[model samples]
Target: MAKMTLESLRKLRVEQKEAIERRDTGDKSIHIIVGMGTCGIAAGAKEALNVFLGEAYTRKMTNVVVKQTGCMGLCHAEPTVEVKMDGMPDTLYGKVDADVAKKIVEQHLLGGKLVNEHVFDYPARDIHKE
Candidate 1:
């Protein structure tokens, strides 16, 4: 390795900061949470996660955050993904493969439309009030 220069150090710092900011969710409103538990992983959640992250980066989605969590207790629906966005009902999608992940990014995140078929859960509305 060559000697480190002051200018080169500063450039490196800037580049590292930008990369960190991309993964930060401080200002992001939309959150895509992928289940990464044993069952989910067995069902290919890792591939689904990669698709979501890649799609977000490729589409220049600055307001979206992709993250991972443990099992959501939907073992029957392994490889689940939950999407929460402002102005839209929080939705959970099941059996998310690579194709389903892309569809979630394109149809739900970009077009602001829910991908109805894969939706496993959604906020239930109250029907009666006292």
Candidate 2:
């Protein structure tokens, strides 16, 4: 490896910031949250996240936000994804593979149709509240 230059480090930082800006500075009307908790990752959530990112970038989409978050409390449905659209209710899809992730982008995000069957009906309130 070559010696690290301060100037090069600064330039890398700038590029990193710009990438974050690109993902954040948008309409934010569509958010794809991929759960990356331990179980989720072990169940292939990482691949699902990559697929979503690829789809978003391939389509030159700016308004869509693809992010990762902790467990959504559905351990049985480890590789779960949540999509929050502009006008539709937040929908969580369970057991999502790369194929399902692609469908989410093409159908839900682009075509405005929820992917059926995989949709999960998670409970809203905590157990104490119930």
Candidate 3:
């Protein structure tokens, strides 16, 4: 593998820092990430992502941002979704389709209510815990 130069490393660090800062800040906007690996795509992840982005844009939700990522280690439950708001816990919704994505926008984003049945809330383990 090619070694990263000092400048390249610094740039990468800066980008990482920016992303973390954005996630940590008190922004009301929700971040939605659609897993887009082969399994996810085969399950219609792309359609879900498009629905999310389109709705966000149509509603003029400047704060809401949509992105795509690879497999989230849940191949059986492809087309997974990850939603993060400032105060609420990060929600992972699996088996998402366009309809599910629309409901996410309507119920979660607009209503500020979590769709409990669809959410998979894995507890975050603390590394410092004894």
lDDT of each: 0.84, 0.84, 0.81
State the lDDT of candidate 3 residue by residue for 32-128, as single tens digits: 9888989899998999999998998777575788989887777777789999987677888987888888999999888889877788643234411
TM-score of 3: 0.71
TM-score of each: 0.74, 0.75, 0.71
- The superposed Cα distance between candidate 1 and the true structure at residue 65, in angstroms, equals 1.2
Clashing pairs in 2: none
TM-score of model 1 vs. true structure: 0.74
Indicate whether candidate 1 or candidate 2 has the larger TM-score.
Answer: 2
User: How far is 50's C-alpha from truth in model 1 (Å)?
Assistant: 0.2
Show model 1 residue runs off by greater than 4 Å: 1-28, 122-130
Candidate 2, residues 12-106, lDDT tens digits: the string is 77986687687675555688989898989999999999999888877767677788988888878879999998877789899999998998888
Displacement of the residue 7 alpha carbon in candidate 3, Å: 33
Candidate 3 Cα misplacement greater than 4 A, ranges: 1-26, 121-130
lDDT score at residue 9, model 3, on the 0-100 scale: 94
Which prediction has more favorable lDDT, 1 or 3? Answer: 1
Model 1 / residue 81 / CA error / Å: 0.3
Q: lDDT tens digits, residues 37-126, model 1? A: 899999999999999888887765767778998878777887999999987888989999999999998898878899999989532345
- Quick one: ranking by TM-score, best first? 2, 1, 3
